[model samples]
Target chain A: MSVKLKALTKSIWVFHLAASPCNNCDIEILDLLTPRFDIERFGMQLVGSVRHADAILVTGSMNRKARIRLKRVIEQAPKPCFVIALGNCACTGEMFAPSYNQMKPLDEVVPVDAYIAGCPPKPEAMIMGVVALIEATLAAAKK
Target chain B: MKGWGKMSDKATAKTTIIPIGPYHPLQEEPEFFKLHVQGERVVKLEIEIGYNHRGIERLAEDLTYDQVPFLVERICGICSCSHPFACVNAIEDVGGVEVPERAKYIRMFTGELERIHSHLLWLGLAGHFLGYNTVWMWAWKYREPVLDLFELMTGNRNHYAMFKPGGVRRDFYEEDFPRAARLLDDLLRPLIMFRDVALQDPVLQARTKGVGVLTREDCVELGALGPTARASNYCIDVRKDHPYAAYDKVDWDVVCTSNGDVFDKVVVRVLEMVESAKICKQCLEKLREVDDGIDCNLKEIPPGEGMGHHEAPRGEVFHYVRSDGTNRPVRYKVRAPSFMNVPTNNRACVGYTVSDATITLAAIDPCYCCTERTAVVDADSGKQIMTWKELLRLSRQKTERLLEKYNSRMDRIWT
Candidate 1:
């Protein structure tokens, strides 16, 4: 029973948060859950609430509203939680960075453990990033 | 004694109070409602919105025409193409630029693909609220073909980035057309099957039929447009009434319903997907008939204000922009269908059970996560809370209570 539960915990359940991102990251995020990429097969489920998640996957850069929500979700996540920043928008705010409402890389607002870079990263690339994060989570558990 | 007797002529009445928003999940944008209820009937509903506001309209004013397409596309990802397409179409229309024939055909194809995917997405979301996760999963699975086509043609899903002021930013070659056609044909059966199951299932019908019903009288007074308007038996469609792009050239019927319940809305969207597929097939045939040309001409856009409307999967999407003839727009306004329909919540869900309310409200084709923000707050004092987890729990509890009240009321009325 203990072993089975440990395995479950080792596989990270991701809680996704979006800022003022274009629709690109949204679909890329959706693709993460579907069967083709199948991030869930790795036990990486897309969870509903922040508390239940092992890592928070953030897309888009920080907007005024997103900044507050990002802090809330990050703070709510349990200890030793990982963060995977998806898309160029979350990393550099891309073209939307200089806009009146947006802030720079999500890391400026919250500490991030990994980055998945693309205009909007492809689904396969998103899967790879999640897999890497799960391994990192498992490694940390071993430690 | 005379003064005391004079004051006895008037009487004051008390009314029931109901709260509907600030946290209630809605299909449209976030809005708050305070309804005065008397025995399952609404006397008056006071509304408050701007809670989910991010000021996209204000932000659009500062962007260039080229930049505005990308910015506007962010308004609603489900209908991501519709925004940029409408923006560019309006810009081009005002500028007196005709997109290449091939570009127009491609636009039609992508627009139809978007319709297919967006409707399927709504179907999935609608299914999730009704505790039917299987339908959600299945609908989303079939939706992948549309997304996959987007990736194959435009190099990305969601925001295709294909639209330019005069034409498309990208073009398809001889080889790409056959591959896309093959993929689309492969996807048709699954879509038809899903539609059949969704429409015929007794469980789905029971949950949706006669729930959150909006009469035709309510629709016009509320200014409801698109599927929401059509569901109430209004024969209004931007594509048909104000034919733009290749809609004039394409042959299809506007799928509508008379029963303005959740089921009718679902039927309209599902049938619309079939129409969208037919349109896609038509675009493919047209593409085969047309010759290759430059997708866009990097032309200068003169300063002007233009209003453009496109039928998104949800409903009518209106884009208003003012260009300064300096490649940037001075003012931009987006009227997403969901934004317009957000006000109709009290009318739609007033008599329905709260659980049914979720299904019915979402049936209007609401864009949920894109148009909303979540914050943890104290229920008693309305103070900001420390943990989202606690807030999430509280919000769920509130919804559950509302659902219970709604169910109990239904029981009383029916039994």
Candidate 2:
């Protein structure tokens, strides 16, 4: 856990992977880069390519079609990359869980390190999720 | 390889095809665009969708009438209210239940505010596409206050969940009026400034003006809706043509422009925001005077078929529901604005330079999440010389060159 935090020594580049999302979480993710939330100021930024990402932020309910693409994209990320499940769909599949098209919730398809709750969590909640990710690793390293 | 091997048999083999999508930042959703470029100009465009499909219509059949509103609200987060607005309208139409007069005003108020926020979001993305990062930042900065208003009113920023079959869920409190009024009043001066800057700015004009022309005939032929059609002078707004909720009750002019170019799309939206603000102001002021209670609770919907559509920020969000005297709808169909609007991009992007194609594709503000579930078949993508960065750099460089040209041409352009 502490070794994964080595990437936290510098800014963390997150690649936004929107599977079969409603797009509320995607917009809320973008909201972080806006003036009010501005995650870049805290040394977190969204990158266009997965190869450059230190962590992959996964959103959506992991429908069958997207599940394939999500698995392929996650496999393409560099080693030691962390996967964070965003929104209720990604964390627990929420209401969309029963749909025939929906695959397993995100964690079932890919290893997930952190989870952010909310149908589409507020920008503040996402920011806190990231901070908690770092804090948890630090606390574990102290042990 | 097989797909392209077959495609290569045509003259298209001579043209370099660039595929954008599935996971491009420009799309933000999973959809694909295949641009056939002859040198610098796009000769043809092919679009593929359905990557985000969660089978909402199929799922709607399983949910009861009461639970369907929440399901539809997630169709597109930005249009969360618009979806439910149309959903309830259809359910109400089926039941032949009349919405409360006060609820009409409250629903209109939320829908109008969503319009303002959605437009600003598009404006910000439009700015980013043109490499006017400052405008992008500013447009989004102004949008935060609108999101705050959504949170204050509906208790959630994205999915308002304000609508049900008979009427609305939340009541407009008089105590909330002053703050909402102040927000609208505060929004005016900046919006006016934004309109002036967006319309009159030389750099923006050079980048967008006369680019991606979707002729009025083209718009009609393609069945484009909302600003895409309005910009082309097609002049069809559901709010004006078929008034529902409080649209007929209130007075606000539908904003339209004749040019049918990318600039006209910007003009229609920028001007439309001012009009939306006026509607919000009117709804709030009149809501204070209306004494009718909200929610005319219709316990059960009778067996019948009904259809309802709202003029969403993007275009018409239509819902068709059929009841069999059961709590659940026997059949449900959704026709989102983007489903109609996205095809216009195929017509609009053609004949434009590759640099201009991105903005044109985005000009319709296509919501692939909403447009998804229509159709999708995997295509074999070949190697391409262009990356998303190269296309962005091409657009930015064009603006830089135009900036340099205009700077030298103007007499008063002293910097």
Candidate 3:
């Protein structure tokens, strides 16, 4: 792993962006911070500002209105920022995939580094997906 | 400003507007609130929503009756069961289908369990908003077992796909009752502890009590539901007022508090948790007496319109379904509790400070994702003065000040 990538893995602050989502995915994201799952132990914390974040955790599907805001948020984040798509809606648009309002999936809107797939993926799955994303980033940097 | 000219002439010169989230960290769902304040006191509050609009009702038109349950389940994760239950109830009402007695018990069990988890989740969030980290941790920790039970029974923690048109998708096995009862028994101690903390904690009382006052008359006029209305001493629980499922058969009292403030909202939710636990235990005992039977029997829905309303964790989750004797529904309307409760903020927040307004807005347990919808325009300078985080910090700072005051008092008493 490159020195920068290795250092990046030490602490990753995520800003949760809700693009039109059913709340199941958002609750699961919050659940990760609670005592049982406790994602803070891994040095992954949720920050209030997108500017202070190393990663953007996007939940929900990208609707026409939210798409504009999502773009602005992605652009505002510093370079080397990763996007982790959480839940089926974010990754695949799931139930709302064909709706007139929904524009695109998370990847089409912003390049996603990792995808956690579930109706609303469990906290354990979320942690594993995030950890794997960090490892993959480090591996890519080395290559 | 374009919009400020219409403001009350008395406070026109002094008001400064602070915007709270179309996409703010404090909000789990995307909602925008424009708080017009005069020296930290909120004079006028404007709410803008629709950021999370998936048009599920419109989408339901394309999906069949069976498919709509899973679709409506996604309306809000916390109240997932309520929507599907309401939807299924509406379909059953249209078709005139008889759900087996056992299925009714199962539906009640899942609905009550959802209530327990959702209330705990809200309590934890409320504690977090109040700057009480310990309460947040403890409440969420206790909530895990409820989710575990959901996973064990319905196969998913959040969106339990157990509801169908006539009945339910899954049935509880005879062996599961003993373990379910045991788990519920375990939850009682934590619930009591949470209740005690909410009742006796000086800081909590200072932070919440009398902060956001909603009158009983206002609650009724505004069409508030569940604990939001109940907290205001408006006794209108769907279970008691219009019992569906096995609610009429089971015995549980509606929890009501007269204060109509944020503290009363907390009180109503905590007390309701106790009631929910009792209902769950009773349902378990009753389930053992019923014979094993099929949970759902698919029957063609005749051409008719029917309404289904259930007491969701937040409030009344009302679903209206119209069928044309086809497989799909022609019109499906969902009115979640937050829909009715959020607008009441217009009246509830006016007399409070900005710090208190945060908790007051939260007191309704406003589901931004369910509402998914906001825009903030400053009336005075046409520039945004405060972000949602700043508003959250303002709210948290009040609690910190209260804690400091409490600590100093303790120190003086000790000396």
In the range B1-415, model 3's lDDT, one tens digit per residue, is 7866576656545989899988887888876789999877888887765567787877899998889999988888888898898998898988778788888888989999999999999999998888787888899999999999998888889888998887777788878878888899999999999999999999999999888899999998888888999999999998898888889898889999898999999999999999999999998888888865745567688777688989998888888787767899866777678867877897899978888887788889888665432223354643343443343365467548845864565455446
lDDT (CA) for every model shown? 0.71, 0.85, 0.84
Which portions of model 2 show Cα errors greater than 4 Å? A1-4, A141-143, B1-13, B375-415
Ranking by DockQ: 2, 3, 1
**lDDT string, candidate 3, A82-134, tens digits:** 88899999989998988877777889877888899998999989888988988
> Candidate 3: where is the Cα deviation over 4 Å?
B1-13, B372-415
lDDT over C-alpha atoms for residue B193 of model 1: 85
Chain B, TM-score, each prediction? 0.79, 0.87, 0.86
| Residue B339 miss distance in model 1 (angstroms) | 1.4
Candidate 2 residue pairs in backbone clash: none
TM-score of each: 0.81, 0.90, 0.90
Clashes of each: 2, 0, 6
Q: Kindly list the interface RMSD, in angstroms, of each predicted candidate in the order they appear.
A: 5.2, 3.2, 3.5
Candidate 1 regions off by >4 Å? A1-9, A21-24, A137-143, B1-55, B296-298, B368-415
- Tens-digit lDDT string for candidate 2 (A1-143): 45556555358889999988898999999889989989999788889899999889999887777787789999999887879999998999888888877768887778898999998999999989988887776676566
Predict model 1's lDDT versus the native. Answer: 0.71
Better of 1 and 2 by lDDT: 2
TM-score of 3: 0.90
TM-score of chain A for each candidate? 0.84, 0.93, 0.94
**How high is the lDDT of residue A118 in model 1?**
85
Q: Give lDDT: candidate 1, residue B374.
A: 38
